[model samples]
Target: MTDEHRSGCPINLSLEVFGDKWSLLILRDMIFGAQRHFRDLQKGSQEGIASNILASRLKHLVELGMLTKRPDPAHKQKAIYSLTEASIQLVPVMAALGSWGLRWQPASEELSIRAQLLEEGGPELWNRFMAELRDEHLGIPAEPSADGKLVRERLQEAYLAVLAERGKSLPSKA
Candidate 1:
């Protein structure tokens, strides 16, 4: 439905919205890393995204209906970004992409751990993750679980563990 579609092809249409290198990285941070603020996204980016590029992509994503931006209640001058349902549905796509990357690319173990877990866990894990994302971004109640290990926490723990093994501490929060 976007005016910028190059063709009727589904892949082309999807690429039109998120084809750029930076957009999906931004979404990945939001979806997997739970980084909602612009400053956090810029500073915490493992790929070192430029500030201007991050700003532009955030605006583009909001315009394309993948994200919503609203004033942060805790900070008057700051904005909080949240994923829309469309972006939430991208969980499986991201998992698949990560799976492919892990198989063929030279990704580091710490970085690829989540993808490995996702590929192994399959749809059931992805569904739980999507449900958690909805709870975080859409204010919906996440399904209750007996075991309290959140996917996000597990990923972070893995990253931290790698850092610990490397004798590198987590970066100080801004």
Candidate 2:
């Protein structure tokens, strides 16, 4: 990014930080999949992000205060990345983007289920999910759920169910 933004608009400022697909994807992986380590982020990428690009983006994110990186206790050579409070506040944005994709794009059922559920759940789910994110990344306590299931767990379960149904119905390779 340039030293100066094109405009002082909030949207413009946000775009400066999240304008590229890779950056958003990195954030998405961290937020949705909990992929923290460099290798995990690279492997979790659906779009096959190159190592150089991933490394560049990770460094950029850390520099921009979206993520924090430190030595991993499990492996001395590896680093653990954590989302900062600023990035944790992006759950609603992700949900909105997913919702828009589901409505306007030719998204598959298995991939679109989480978006569908998030849109259906609306702000309530978004708030709860954000709370859970805080719990995971920020060490903030999450609000207790009535059913004892996390919002993430619920979202993952829905995605898996859709995948299972799709697998059963799709023609198998011969």
> For residues 1-174, could you state the per-residue lDDT of candidate 2 as single tens digits?
565889888999998797899999999999988899998888778788899999999999999999999999999999999999889889889999999999999997888989999899999998998888889888899978999999888988888788787774432212
| Model 1 local distance difference test score | 0.90
Clashing pairs in 2: none
Clash pairs detected, candidate 1: none
> lDDT of each structure?
0.90, 0.88
Q: Which stretches of candidate 1 lie over 4 Å from their true place?
A: 1-3, 171-174
User: For model 1, how does the per-residue alpha-carbon lDDT over 12-63 read when each residue is reduced to its tens digit?
Assistant: 9899888888998999999998999999999888788988999999999999
Q: How large is the C-alpha RMSD of every model relative to the true structure?
A: 1.9, 3.4
Give the least accurate 10-residue stretch of model 1, judged by summed lDDT. 165-174
